[model samples]
Target: MWGRQMFHFLLHWMLGAICFGFLVTAFSVLLSQLVITVVWCSLVIGASIMQDRDLSEYSPTGSSTSKHLSCSHALCEESPNCASPKQPCPYTANYYSENTTSTGFLIEDILHLASSSDRGSKRLVQAPIIIGCGRKQSGGYLNGIAPDGLMGLGLGDISVPSFLAKSGLTRDSFSMCFNEDDSGRIFFGDQGVGTQNSTPFLPLEGKYTTYVVGVEGFCIGESCVDRVSLQALVDSGSSFTFLPDNVYEKVSKEFDSKVNATRTNFEGSPWEYCYKASSQQLLGIPSVTLLFSVNSSFVVDKPICLVYGTQGDNHCISCCFFEV
Candidate 1:
């Protein structure tokens, strides 16, 4: 029989710590971005895991309680290189960034979770979960990207959420709400409010491994500048929003034309359409909105962001955008 479990965890920015009964580990939240959860292996010195405990006791490879998943496991079947049933299951993940990748083996370990009782008291529960013990990492990972480890919330057979759901520990659903101060809470097995707006998830190559939604077009203020039919992936792990090259040009140009400010540039910055404007002037800037099917729309209230220059005297009004 399947059981439904719901739990909440606090997040500071993109990082959060989950207690595993005997140990506490910090992870970067990759909401609906990655297909598998990953923890750096003991081989990587100076990792948070190693600094938190003795090398012998906390090592995933050395821990007697941790078990290597066999290649014959169901999760291992997704790998194209799984040949030997007796061998450990291997996994690899490639990111959108160039030369960024994580390759490792899968292992099973116990995860400690806090659950609320019917009386409103909290209690600890243990469950087995599969994790990718990453042995090697490259590219942005070495440069403070998920410096500790990653907690993948994407849709996949091996993801933590999916594993918990398959084990009948929780319903296969989760929700994340981020606050203005960069703090947020995540609720597992949460079915959101009935009045909330929703967009349908689109399938990719006949598989629903990532959250993809259809976008009809974009609006800058009251004017609808461009009409686009594309599928957008909702990824919270990304610090900035990305758009197609053609759409990016139209939107940026439209935004620049509407604002009454001088155009400026910051060397080595990703923002191309920056403006030299005062705070009072920015208040009159137009808002950005995304149009979806069924008349559902997402509004960007504060589209212009204040970016300080190196000298700290100059300010630039920037929008998060990168052509994909």
Candidate 2:
């Protein structure tokens, strides 16, 4: 009877200990809830910090933070928007310097007459043209103004040039030599020979895309001038070429002896003229070449066929168009 009474006493002591443990656990949970309500506004951040999670220890600094801080989540951190603070800009000082990686105009990916297999190809047989200068996979296009004012080429019909061909035709280096005269206008110097405008065929890597190739050569005839550069646009959709004002005066003098050479159609515009140059004459015309410090020199030798007005005398034509 004394041993049975000792067993009941042991059971009572165990029950009391279990009740004390339950009270202490309930108090701890209430205190934790109160601390979180007073300290944190969100559950995830509060719980993670309280638990001392591993992700909470990470902190982005330097360019990593700067990149994401000012940008939206849509942009990639590796883009120029997120440039590393450690990497310096090559264009910080002189932007047009030789060491800088420059961008040029993207050219429209249209095949020339040499590559065409139809009548449209034959019409542009000797027109001055420019091919794309970069790879196809890269997102780029030809950007230029039609001096002839004719626009009909669709965006879908073009194709980028082969990489090997583009590389061979464009500047081999990433550097461009641009100069501004006292007038603050840009000038293109061909191997130290400066032109009033940007040099032809100097494809900047990023700035401009492939533009139409301009024609440069002496006009042959009665009133010919030796050094004339005709800004020519090769349009497969057109049947004729158009020249601006002062440039035409010099060219007309070469074709017709009676043509007046002193007339400037517009105030200070360059005279533009067009003449039929047979393939034989095109071969004889001095090769118009643009030499880039980076790559191989581009030479233009073609017989450009231009449209003449009903009056027959040199009249400024607006644009050249043909039936598709």
Candidate 3:
């Protein structure tokens, strides 16, 4: 079963890479905007009813912190949208909070939309989505932030790419080009794999699905590799890559030795390795080189130095691809 599935998956992507460019140009009407813009109030409330589940029942604790909500209006202090009893309450999504070991439930939802329509035909797209609908914790830091939804584009059947392909609107392929300002466009359909050095994303053994890639090791400072081999998940869902405790300690020591590292923390950040200065200015600072299989090496330098602050004074230099 696995062999055949892998064969077909790769086959479709190969065909998609070859034909997507022509399709985008010729049938411009098929080019659809790759985003979910909104969700109506009725659907949320109705889905809760339809599933026979009260969104309010599932909370991080056996109880809920939203007691401040007026039973008369059923509204919380933070958001007025879930004001009515008819409105859908957020679910307790588990493992959604990375900072703590709290347990939560999974909130599965659906997205219905039309792909980008050129001045021509219109096609509606329906996708299955797993939404993380809880705060980083039960309180202050990112509390009440879960109501706003997030879209996952992982290597799973429920992901947007898989949904589009299954719906027969396009091939199982997509590409993205982004700018330094964070503005970008995602090209779907026969977006070719640029260059022949493209590496195949390997399948993982566990229940959770992800695009696991084979990593040889990380080379710090120029292209020198200290010989570390491992498998890593190429998860775009995460803002920072996570490593095992021992491995993180080793890398942290090496990073400190290389660069005069200054550690800082945000009010809610879950990271330990942070820097106040830009990545370029760190003397003897190693350029992070990720050595993956098939001779695929990713070098990080510019984006490594990120400015993160409400007032624009803070900067952080972080690196990791979740390794095991």
Q: Which candidate's TM-score is highest?
A: 1
Better of 2 and 3 by TM-score: 3
- Estimate, for each residue in 238-306, the C-alpha lDDT of model 2 and write its tens digit: 223334445444444444443333232333422343334444433443322332232323443332333
Q: How do all models score by TM-score?
A: 0.77, 0.23, 0.51
Q: Which segments of model 1 are wrong by more than 4 Å?
A: 1-34, 43-58, 61-65, 77-83, 117-121, 267-269, 305-308, 311-324
Name the regions of candidate 2 deviating beyond 4 angstroms.
1-200, 204-208, 221-224, 229-231, 258-324
User: Pairs clashing in candidate 3?
Assistant: 20-190, 32-116, 33-116, 92-105, 94-104
RMSD score of candidate 2 (Å)? 33.1
Ten consecutive residues with minimal summed lDDT in candidate 2?
A: 10-19
Query: What is candidate 1's lDDT per residue for 91-169, written digit by digit as tens?
Result: 7777655576788888887777776655999876666788778888887666656544566777877777787788887
Candidate 1 vs. true structure, TM-score:
0.77
Q: Best candidate, lDDT-wise?
A: 1
Candidate 1 root-mean-square deviation in Å: 8.0
